[model samples]
Target: MEQRWDGSVVLEAGRLLFRGRLGTTHAHAHAAVQVVVVRSGTVELADRYGGRLAVSAAVIPSRATHSLHAEDAQGTVAYYDSDSHVGRALRSRFPTAPGDRVTDWTAAAVQSACPPDAPGGGRAAAAPHPAVGRAIDRVRSRLHGPVTLEEVATALHLSPSRLGHLFAEELGLPFPAYVRWVRIRRAIELVRSGATLTQAACGAGFYDSSHLTRVVHEMFGMAPSQLLRDVQWEPGPQRIRPSGPGLAGAP
Candidate 1:
């Protein structure tokens, strides 16, 4: 699914971003828990077994199978490393995910997702340890390439075992798992930037388009065809906007 660069920001150290109109995603699950604050319109989140709920804003637990939709729903989606201190904090903040509406953190978190750059980025938080943050940056720096944790650790003058622990203890997600997720995200971004699936797959470190397709569906739930169905994107000065209109009513 390739399109022009939609006006969205990937911000707050890769933990927060604005989900633009890529239409509905295929049924998928995520490795990291998510908090979505609907800005313009209502969105319906449907679970795998067909159960559904309509909410203005929602917190979704990790590994939960679900898909979100609205004709043109726009929102800030924040992701937390499932094992990080902040990720653990979110459980308390939400209390009831995929069912709970955000009460306190949405406003601040959504604002934080927006930055000067469209598809923008910022430095990671120096939590858990600076080394862990550095490792994350290194992985993110290479969108397409096989980078082992050992390599990253070696570069940082640490053993693979110690660095792997940093990833787990500090970031919550292990080095390998985090790297996988980053590759998937990178492929999606490449597709959004107008690359074909094959190109995106290669550019984002996948073995092939088939690999990208399968993983995208697994991680995000939406199949490639479904996600790419009507993706509209652009490179622009992005800003927070109301979801506007589409898909509503308690499902």
Candidate 2:
């Protein structure tokens, strides 16, 4: 019952696992690439650019913003570290494994840069909102220091407004909001994984623990301390816990 974002839940090797029900309209963009395997259920994924596709289980590349809406009321879902050794091994066996597999291998290449367990689930793995993948890479690489949205835009060769539009249209959040969400999410993972509050905050690009706390409370509606109190870790297969009422936004 590991419930923390940074936690892991282990399953019997080769055993099929089921993730719980997921939201119908939730979208998020992460720093790492993600491979989603739906053991038993129907899930619909929609990209930021109004592209919609149905996939039982699929590998989604990094920095591509997408949402998941479960077609079956009662179904099972599993997620793996897209950048993990297990993930790579699984991808190598893609289409050959089972279920529907959709992905751009060119995007998969970016995931090989680090070992699977490098931390923060190898950087969120949920793909970015289209071409903003490069911008996200810059954000991850420079998260430790102050990096402006303008700088990210420049690196991606787009105007700030265009970048902002991409984020809003694709990921369902504006650029600054998305950046804050990512930073806070990373900070939460770090803290739950054993970093001191201050350390986690700073490491995840927050000005201070208070800053992290504010964002966490705003997004998750719970204080970080309370959130980490019952945390546990599990490995093997992805499990989607029941969503709380306030747990809005992307899946």
Candidate 3:
């Protein structure tokens, strides 16, 4: 039989897939487009301005501040980089701005919009700029330490100003924002391994547990304590094997 888990997180070059139970959330927003595919029950979302929606499956645009309430709902939440083709396609099909678009969608429609995965686990049809790619590599390698745009630019033989421009142009987000997202991802991995909030915070290069808490809450709309509790975590293809307490059903 296929294994089941309380939660599973799969990371790729340009995508992050999370599957499991969801609880009521605080209002928050991040820099990626979110696609939720529901397997059962309904997901009720409220925007920062009092807009409300109940969806089985939905696509939320990047930077759209919203709170989610899903008492018994279980499904997959896939986050795609705003610059990736998938992200662009989703925005094109859905056509809504931040805080304005949380339209209901279907699994088949989402899958159809997703192009074939490129080699090496990248779903982005277009590769990032050469400098941006190198910068990403450098950032990934130094998630546990300070990584500055100037340092990366110097190493790549480019000026900090130029590198920053390229990052925004190619990734659709600022360099610092990208680094913060990476740190968040790393922290989540650490939490899934049973690390305490402080430990995970330090491991992911946050100043302290409080900093991590704030970032997680702002980006994901939930504190780590609630999101990582009693969940089995599955890392990406390049990381360690899946291990942790299991959920009751297949995700």
Candidate 4:
């Protein structure tokens, strides 16, 4: 039987945090680096290569395909932009081999690396290129309509090819992937504001509910209903929080 995810979610620029019971998730990959800290029961992390590790805590590197199997297990899951301060810190502290994607750690170690202050305040991360920044703002503003890289680039006075290159170089994800993320985030925002899934999908510029459902499941490993159903949501900060202490100084 497929389990339901019940938890609280906090979204900040470049970071998303969830605390609650984890549902079984299908194998999926996204651009953010993911960290899972299991508090009770077990959550299994499986890779595409048939390797499986039952972990209390683990970090899955960016864009690495994997799945989670958790039943009646309570834990925390955090997604971080690979280029953000804390994301860089975690990757730095727990360096992975060239091809390795998932690193399992003891619960204590995971907690220590991700201290309460780690997600709050510290030094500001380097800003993205000016064009990339503008392009992002443009995407957010146009989420209610069709947004295309060519149109965004034209408005920003850059060729589509140049803009696409910058997105990959600065954000570590392609332009299309970033657009999908923005759309999904916008849909979640609409749902949090009391819109039904169908309404949220249209409001977020998805073709319809099914389009939104497919995107959510592909990127997050759960249907929009399962992911957004009856969960507490903390107001997200207007901007990304500065990096804090912990993994930054880790060896």
Candidate 5:
């Protein structure tokens, strides 16, 4: 079933469940344990630690920071909330299993978990090529520092020219252009989260606010101040509170 931002479904045995094709980069964490069984096609799961795991189906824990890359030109996934009874049953059946086998029982289980009207669809995009994955990892890790094409190429043991070519071929963007996009995207997040333009720009590894403004305008067609004008600031949970012997009536 397709879940809305605040909606979730509890799956039962003999019910078939599925999710539509989705491609997104998460800016915040989500809280839902999911067990995904791929009836057909492949999926690549990437974590914050720069590790990429390719699996046809896998169990994902709630609040784990990760992104999904669909391998099937059109990938279909059968999934359910991991806390549900159906989820537990499927987990028991799989039992930490690892292979590419698509058993009849697994197929039946998938169909049973999904709604009758759900379509068995596939992902519309390809997984990141190996070179693209490496490049992306390097860029993401260095988003808070100066990142140059030569530096990334050196880290990946590829020539600058060759790396540029590979990026264009695999990701459809020049290496430098991709890096700029990453920087701008990161800056947008920081700015939206109550950081000053200068603070956000510097945090995102841009030379200064002016550089950030230029890139933001090019990518988003808006100035940082204008884009962030309506941003609402909310206080985060207090990590520590004043206490101890001198805490009371000291002033």
Candidate 6:
């Protein structure tokens, strides 16, 4: 943390990975859901209608736009892949709430739910439509290079529009957006395996390190350095394991 700001961080990751932080952030939205838990002090957030809501613990749904302000507060904010088991588990933490911020924080508690072993546990592909599955396979195969929607559509003998529609309908996001996520996922994995930022960026299709940083900040509301600076990770089965609460330096 910078001198002007007083903030501490704690990041623990696994195949069921997550990034937790205790700090403030400008307005931003990410592709993944975020679980914001204020252990001591309270934080304020603006809802959809621009109403200021105070909360200690809440589940911010994926892609939900919001900003936070926390100073000298003991809190834990965990970003979860909404498609993962832990993400679904956190979403179910709240009672019936139409909007963000679990209204009655005292009444409900949020827990990180997952198996002892993951990345292979409970992640059996809930396979998408056969065509979509095949499309995804193609994307994974061409991850090291460029694989546009048109090329994928042509390969599958389907019109671009039909393929785009199928991607949105079956995956709940556009083809390009999904591709970007895959690239970021690969980049993160490369970093976990001791690759430098620049190397990870180029290896994962990002133009450079700065390009990767901007995309990550736009998606996760924080620069990758702020998030990964203190994380000392060790390569695991299919993920990286942090040495402890907050490793002092990068791996």
What TM-score does prediction 5 earn? 0.43
lDDT of 4 by residue, 11-68 (tens): 6666766666666778887666677777888778787777788887776655567888
* Global lDDT scores for all candidate models: 0.57, 0.48, 0.65, 0.66, 0.46, 0.57
Give per-model CA RMSD.
Answer: 7.1, 10.6, 5.7, 6.8, 17.5, 5.8
Ranking by TM-score: 4, 3, 6, 1, 2, 5
Two-way lDDT contest, 5 vs 6, winner: 6
Whole-model lDDT, model 5: 0.46
Which portions of model 3 miss their true places by more than 4 Å?
1-7, 11-14, 81-100, 103-112, 115-126, 233-251
Off by over 4 Å in 1: 1-27, 38-56, 61-124, 237-251
Candidate 4 colliding pairs, count: 0
Candidate 1's C-alpha lDDT?
A: 0.57
Candidate 5 C-alpha lDDT tens digits along 1-251: 21111111112222222333322223212222234444345555565566666555554432344555544322333333222334334334433322123242333344344332243221112214676577677887999998988998899898999888877544434577667756765665565455788998999999999998776554433455544553343344211111111000000
Off by over 4 Å in 6: 1-16, 19-21, 37-39, 47-49, 72-124, 234-251
**TM-score (all chains, Cα) for each model:** 0.61, 0.46, 0.73, 0.79, 0.43, 0.69
Model 6 scores a C-alpha lDDT of 0.57
**Ten residues in a row with the worst lDDT in model 4?**
242-251
The better-scoring model by TM-score among 3 and 6 is: 3
The better-scoring model by TM-score among 2 and 4 is 4
Kindly indicate the candidate among 1 and 3 with the higher lDDT.
3
Clashes of 3: 2
Which of candidates 1 and 2 reaches a greater TM-score?
1
lDDT value for candidate 3? 0.65
Query: Which prediction has the highest lDDT against the true structure?
Result: 4
